[model samples]
Target: MPVSRVASRFAGIEESPTYAILDLAAELRARGESILDLNGGEPDFDTPGHITAGGTQALGGGFTHYTPSRGLPALLEAIGDKLLKDNGLSVDPARQVIVTPSAKHALFLSVMTLLGPGDELLIPTPSWVSYPAMARLAGAEPVFAPLSTDNGFRLTRENLEERLTPRTRALLINNPNNPTGNVLTATEAEAVAEVARAHDLFVITDEIYEKVRFRGEHLSIAALPGMADRTLTVNGFSKGYAMTGWRLGYVAAPEDVSAQMLKVQQHTVGCAGSFVQRGGISALTGPQEPVEEMRAAYEARRDLLVEGLSGIPGFVCPSPDAALYAFCDIGGTRFADPAAFTTWLLREAKVAVTPGFAFGPGGERHVRLAFATDPKTLGEAVDRIKTAMERL
Candidate 1:
């Protein structure tokens, strides 16, 4: 029998390119191909022993039951203290924070809570692949405001002004952004905040990579005056604490919005894992030496990869100041399409990288190389990339 007709909301959505490449690499590796995977966004470091021990203690203490829809009070309090200490932002543990399965889930919750059919979300181009798709899933239109390579992919006040419309309901900002690794300055962030305030739009800021900055400090738009009430800040332990498998994230928003999001969470995920929440408590309260060590390693890899890629003919490699990615331009070269170039590199160089076209329209001529792998693997991948460029 034929299946029931699928919903129209899913018509425009497609598989995530990051995972698609990962699957392909896994298949090729199963066939004995020496694949060097640079397509991942996860850090290579293992979760800290203390964090793992905390999870173990929770399990042994028989704390596996369902938690409150919002989160454990202790975890929320820890997160509140962390926000104040790290980002200079204040949040009420009982009213403002809701722990979710992951930051990706937090984004979905924000969209569902604040958006609907007639609403619009203003997103910067060459952004994380899920932003527009998530907006579509929530029955909102996603309007693109393209950031230029000439501007280091940083959004400006003019960029925000040009994209504002009557239906614009929110603006999404990802600092130390994915794929592009662009971190906005405090001045630029305040300018964007000004536009959001003028348009009366909710600002959903993803600071998942806040701890991954290299050249300068990380700033939060939520900290700006008049923004705390309108901004929903989403972050988690995945990127910063090497806890991707833990699937722990949280959102801090105005009390009223946070209340509504708790209802959504009750019907949806119900709550993040209880034991995992315990581990998250430790992640927030524990010593941050592991975080710093991981960041230092990523910095070294970034330097090596950027320096190596810069030597390739017909390639333009920009030094990323934050995040663990090096987005390179491959236009005016032998390759014509980013997707095609990625496929060719995987087959010829046995190195896996993400195609830039998956990021957004403005990423068509570029590709993203992850520096989250080990130094030895990254060095080998660079050598292979150089050889591949020579072949082209």
Candidate 2:
């Protein structure tokens, strides 16, 4: 058999380092190594009981059929209602929402619908690993707008303007950001919205961590005046509801964009699972107790992880106000490349973390540690990391 040529669109895309490291650590653990995995972005807690019961009811009711391409009207309505209640934004269920298999799928569909060859996307650096790859898959160029550690890795209006160009079609914003745990302030979001308005660029906002915010409120860039018409908001049940395995997510956009995305989705995933959509409805409409419980637990874990890492020599740990990860810089210490450092840590410290460089340039000296684990395990991982650094 001859080897077939791989597609050029996927030529430079790399696997997600967080999941990749978790897999490697799991394999080692199978061989009897005690690995403390901080590389995974999933909550250690189980899915809420009410949400699980809803899925059970859905299964018992035989909801195993395909839904509309945009999603079930009930789920869409619940999503819209949830958005308005939680984020102070109104969305029309019939035209503004499309439920996807995951937030990743929603992003892919958005890129496919909005971009074409030669179109450009301005992606903030130290971003989630999938953003650039999704842009590339859509045959669009991804221009990096680097975020500084001094600014909590949040994108400012100045940074957005510096990266804008005539070919730029969209700007991606991840608030309560993955890897960095940075949430864009309302002031910063307004600035970014201004630039997008000036350039007539589509704004793609990933608010997957919206419900997981620990500090102040999670503000949507689309909530700013005039941004609602131009923003595509991507969110999911994975991070906030502990429904990662459910693989359900959604995008709310302008009617035109949602219509186009529905077409793209129909050709690709068709629709998300009907029963899962029911579960999602329960998630949005059910009690707020579980959400608050998870938030409280994660807040405690975040404090523990941040405090522990602070004591480690040569470690510069920034306090993340939201989300589940702590992104720490390990440069000027024993580690040179973050990937190599992660490998060494796994082998020596028996701890696994995602290499920061996998996120993009400017992330080379850092690593992402997910504090979604219990405090006992997280404390041990920090101790092991400190011991390993001392040895180096």
Candidate 3:
């Protein structure tokens, strides 16, 4: 048999910058370099004890096997209940939800299922890096609609309208967005729903950071009037429950759309881990204090990092209201761009931060640093950065 050629879909898809930075940090750490990492997107806190216990109980009870292609029955019900309680969307779990190994996986499933060649997915700029790649891998074109700092990085209808074309088939929304941490306001959510309705476009809303918000109430586009039938809501236990390693997340969509997504889930990654699904049930239904505590900690860290970055001579940072990143504008800095600034910091300050261009358009002059770790460590990074700035 001839050796199989690599698929073209893999071309131009770089490793996620978050993971790439992590791998680089690991290699430096192995070589005895003290790298203060602020490049991760996961919570530094441990997974809540009760959720761990739930998985342990299931494992002990011999739940170590494949679940139904969609997900475990009870787990799906728990997710449905969570949607109603937290997101205000009523769903029939059996037909509307599919568990995947991670929120990223669920997103991949969605783009693969709904998009194809020549179709365009309108993504707000500075999005999580995987979104555009997911669309591309599915043979669709990703059209980035740049969200400006002038608008506080909010997704406006005007932005979407300008990007729309005959081939635009879907929109990917990340609320409490990753790099910017801009939570969608009620008005913006309505704008999204309005455009979605006007264009009859399928909507994929990534709400993984819902629990990590610091500002306004998190609203789901699916919960808005006329949006339930067209929106795919994606959430996971990674940021909120510190379950990144557990690799558990889910997508809830209309039954018809979910049915197609299930075919993708069924063929690729059969289901989330059986016992992991048990853990997810506990994550959704269990006490949410840990999630709150983590959010509070991140809020404090955001303030610290933002204040520090602002004081630095050439950096302008906005206080992010959600998620773990502080996107700082470094265009005024002496270094040419975010990449140069990040490289300088890593070499001189012994710290790691993500270059913002990895996140796509509108991130050209910035760098994103995660506030996911402890205050002391963050303080140290700030000091190191300050010192590095002074020495230069």
Report, for every candidate in turn, its global Cα lDDT versus the true structure: 0.90, 0.88, 0.90
TM-score of each: 0.97, 0.96, 0.96
What is the lDDT ranking, best to worst? 1, 3, 2
* Comparison by TM-score, 1 against 2, better one: 1
Q: Is candidate 1 or candidate 3 better by TM-score?
A: 1
Residue pairs in candidate 3 whose N, alpha carbon or C atoms collide under 3 angstroms: none
Once superposed on the true structure, which residue ranges of model 3 sit more than 4 Å away at CA? 1-4, 17-27
- Tens-digit lDDT track for model 2 on 1-392? 76658877877677776666777788899999999988878898999999999998999999899999999999999999988987878989889999999998998988899999999999888888889989988999999998877766767788888888889999988887888887878787888899989989999999999888888678888888999999999999998999999999999999988888989999988999999999999999899799999999999899999999989887898888789999999886777888888888898999998899878766879999999988899989989988887887
**Per-residue accuracy of model 3 over 140-218 as CA lDDT, tens digit each:** 9999999898877887799889999999999999988989988888989999999999999999999999888899899
The CA lDDT at 137 in model 2 is: 87
Worst 10-residue lDDT window, candidate 1? 17-26
* lDDT at residue 50 of model 2 (Cα atoms): 93
The CA root-mean-square deviation of candidate 2, after full C-alpha superposition on the true structure, stands at: 1.8
Model 1 Cα lDDT, one tens digit per residue, 310-348: 888878989998998999999867897888888888989
lDDT of 3 at 335: 76
Q: Which candidate is the best by TM-score?
A: 1
Worst ten in a row by lDDT for model 3: 16-25
